[model samples]
Target chain A: MKAVGFKKHLMLEEEESLFNFEQAIPEATGHDLLIKIEAIAVNPIDVSVRLNGTETYETPKVLGWDACGIVVAAGSEVSLFEEDDLVFYAGAFDRPGSNAEYQLVDERLVGHAPHGIDIAEIAAMPLTSLTAWESLFEKMRLELEEPSLNQDKTILIINGAGGVGSIATQLAHLAGLHVIATASRPETIAWTKGHGADQTINHRRSMPKQLHELGYENVDYILGLNDIDGHWKEIAEMIKPNGRIVSITRNEQPLDLGLLKSKSAEFMWEWMYTKSYYQLPEMITQHEILEKIAALLEQGRIKSTANQIIDGINAETLKAAHALIETNSSIGKIVLCK
Target chain B: MKAVGFKKHLMLEEEESLFNFEQAIPEATGHDLLIKIEAIAVNPIDVSVRLNGTETYETPKVLGWDACGIVVAAGSEVSLFEEDDLVFYAGAFDRPGSNAEYQLVDERLVGHAPHGIDIAEIAAMPLTSLTAWESLFEKMRLELEEPSLNQDKTILIINGAGGVGSIATQLAHLAGLHVIATASRPETIAWTKGHGADQTINHRRSMPKQLHELGYENVDYILGLNDIDGHWKEIAEMIKPNGRIVSITRNEQPLDLGLLKSKSAEFMWEWMYTKSYYQLPEMITQHEILEKIAALLEQGRIKSTANQIIDGINAETLKAAHALIETNSSIGKIVLCK
Candidate 1:
């Protein structure tokens, strides 16, 4: 199968950074499902894993997490998916990712793709949806099924225009929380508000003052989507006593947790890769969440966040997508389709 | 009413460290409950409030939390208790404490005292019981009533022979988790095991190595009762993926939260005073918890953690008790009674 990857981590500008190659199609065994890639999505994790490496790979490492594909074969233990079943998934962190034509993904991680949406749109939803779902419901323990119970609750999504933030703002709003999301630019602010943010604050400005002007002393929960270390103090200040704070952003600096001690606050990290990286039993929940997200999309309760869909799944197309991601101003998801 | 307090924070040996003074008894209003002289329990917080200060108090600051006494009066808003009701409570942090002949506490923070327990025994329970309960069930989100569901879980309680630890060990045991508590001394080890610790590990040594030898890779939950800064690395290493860690022990230095990032772990602060300190509506949950604790005591499902009962709730007795706390070797709780 033809794939795009690199033998060594390098900058996108380099000649050997990402190049097309051919490899034998891997077999489906145990819980694995051999998938023929249909469309792929770009996320910050893809950029991080591509650049933040020192070791050289014996074989080129195919790098892509979010994808919607058709299963070509199923393993002996595969029960969730079958041959020719259209599926969506955020592939495991350690595995050869979805950039390849024939990729092997565990059946537990695959979910039935929504037939109502295009392949690129279905590909865009999995990674961000799973992250947003787990951040609010699993890590923060919000009651998603009982939206009425969350009527008085409030949540602040730190970066509301990004891939995960766009979805999180919508899900949190759907959960009946008074959503306060942050976006610096005019277009991004409108984008966040369109996605169900009740109020939008600028990440570049003083968020606490803006939050105060909106008549909330503190929010019941905080979902940190960008620059967690930079926003730590504000997050600590803006969280209500006994509030839960979940962050998917990686902190480059130290965070003072003592600020939350008197408030008895809860801090949870919702790394989407945790379940797959650890091979935890709850990995199957990703499939369940994707199924729910697909239903929500099909019902028109939520729309796909795929903003920029490029033609072709080749090395050149993925490189252009990665460059757009590097700009950090792109709203929602960027996907590549063939 | 006579109260033991100090105008300025000082060492225990100082003449002005603690002194007796008479003041007019306070009136019960709002949610206040006026409790007459009975018994007061000494905790580490008392020592902290007494010594960790620099400014001279206008009115000598009274310091005590746990108490069991007859409610001499009840406020207009008090529905949980009536006048002359015997109650146990851990009073709010900002209010005048229980180191007095009479103390006024919010009724929501007070619970009906168990008739089966001695006054000093009941006094020793409030602060410690509340801390342990909040740490285990509320902060850590452990299902206490449904113990069978927790059969596969394990908990590591750091400092298992101290006031809060003694109760926490029992509570975690009742919750059906395999309790591994830390105790270095032979007597402390025996005391921890007696309180239902399934295994005793030495905190002075490498906990993860010891844990490995005991047929466990990592604990599902960790209750950090002592030296959070000291055990932080090990706590980070020893917590299983998606584990919850609750700490009452304040970290003097900054703690790196990034260590738990890949595992997506949760860190919660279990400050028992948060609800009352913030005047949150859920302060009444403290009353409900204490009521449950009293029933547990009455049923012999749990026991009082009081180890020493000093006669007289006076300046001298409090000073002596505070001195014992400063030693950091005294196991269980120390109480003063009239």
Candidate 2:
């Protein structure tokens, strides 16, 4: 099988940073499904794994998480997927990822791909959709069934034009929460509002003032997609009493959780790959969430965050996608299709 | 009206640490009730307030929370209690405290005193009970009615013999959870066991090894009644994936919240005074919780945590109680009654 991977940490411009390699196609075992990769998306995790981790690797580490693919074979223990079934998943962190001709994913982490969407679009949905869905419904404890109760509540999404933030804004809006999303550029601000943000605040400016101008005294929830340490103080001040804050961004410095003590507020971290990496009991719920997200996308209730789609699933195309994501100014998602 | 208060921060032995003062007996206004204070409990918060904080107030600050008294009068807007009703409460932090001969408290923060408990015993309950109830039910999201579902779960209560921990262990036990409490001393261990801990581990020892030896690997919930910074690493290691941690103790330094990222765990602060201090919409819930707790005590389902009773609610007695709490070795609660 042909794969895009790296043996050492290097900049994306380096030819060896990501190169074509040949490896034997792995056979499915236990709950694993051998899937023929059709499309893959570029996320910050993919870049981080490729560049930031230990450089001493015995084998080239294939790094990609979001994928739309078809199962070519299934292990004896697999029950959710079968050969030829189309699927979408954010595969586990410890395993070989989806930047390959064939990848093995646990059936519990795979979801049926939306019937009508293109492979690239479906590929872009899984990682961010799972993150956005779980961050809102599970971590933030938002009740989608009771939109009326959420009508008075508001959520502020930092870096709202990004992959996870785009989906989070949509989900928060669908839950009937007033959405205040942070986007510095005009295009990004317009993009966030198009995806369901009721109001937009510039992350580069004073967010609290902008939120106040939009008539929200404080938000009931805050979903931080970028620069958690930078936005910590503002989030602490902008969260209502007993409010919730969930962040996907890593903080460079320690956070003063004491600031939230007076409000009796909660702080949670939403790592989408947590269940799969930890093999937690709730790993099967990822399959359920992805299926629901696929349904919503098919029904047009939610839109795919796939902003830039590059043709071909080769090392060259993967490197291009990675380079675009490295800029950090890319609005939504970058995808590479077969 | 006689009151014990301080205008300056000073040592307990200093004449001004807690001094005698006189003021008019405040009239009940709106939801307020004029209570003839019979007893008051000195909590760690009282000691912290006296010693910590940068500002010295122009007016003498009366520092007390837990109180047991008779309602001498009720405002026109008060409907929950009448004149002469025996009530117990942890009144609002922004108001004049219960360390006075007569005090005005919002009816919503007051509860009917248990029928069989002494004034000192009842006074010991309000603050700790509210903190425990909120930490377990509201913050940890434990369901009290559904014991069957709760039976499989376990909760680790840090500092199990403290005022809040003593009550929380019983509540968690009554909710059907296996309660693993942390007690450093033999007397505290016995006290926690008597309060309903299924097992006890010394917080000073390896809690993780102790839990594993007791046939458990991780806990589903952790109520941190003591130091968060000291036990953070162990707590992070012992919490099951997606577990909840609620802390009442304040951390002097920043916390490494990133440690819980891969597990997607939650951390919440359980400040019982948040509702009243913030004037949150859910302030009424505190009243409801106290009333229910009062009923539970009346039915003998739980008991007051009062460990030592001082002779009177005067400066000398309050100073003595404060000094005892400052040592950080008090078993349950310290009450100063008139």
Predicted structure with the largest lDDT when compared to the true one: 1
Fraction of native contacts under 8 Å reproduced by each candidate: 0.91, 0.90
Worst 10 residues of 1 chain A by lDDT: A107-116
Which residue segments of model 2 deviate by more than 4 Å? none
Report how far residue A193 has shifted in candidate 1, in Å. 1.4
- Give a tens-digit lDDT track for model 2, residues A1-338: 99989988888888889989999999999999999999999899888888896666768889999999999999999999878999999989899999999999999999999898888889998999999989999988898768998998889999999999989888898889989888989899899999989888888887888888887789889999999998899999999999999999888899999999999999999998889888988999999998999899999989889999999987899888888888889999999989
lDDT of 1 by residue, A172-260 (tens): 88888899999988899999999999988887888889988988889999999888999999999999999999999888888899999
lDDT of predicted model 2: 0.91
Q: DockQ for candidate 2, please give it.
A: 0.91
Q: What is the DockQ of each candidate?
A: 0.93, 0.91
Pairs of colliding residues, candidate 1: none
lDDT of 2 by residue, B1-338 (tens): 99889988888888999999998888888999999998889899999889876678777899999999999998989999988899999999889898999999988888998888788889999999999999999998898878998999999999999999989998999899999999978899899999999999999889999999999889999999888999999999999889999999989888899888888899999999999999887888888998989989988989889999989788888888988998999999999879
Q: In terms of TM-score, how similar is model 1 to the real structure?
A: 0.99
Q: Report how far residue A281 has shifted in candidate 1, in Å.
A: 1.1
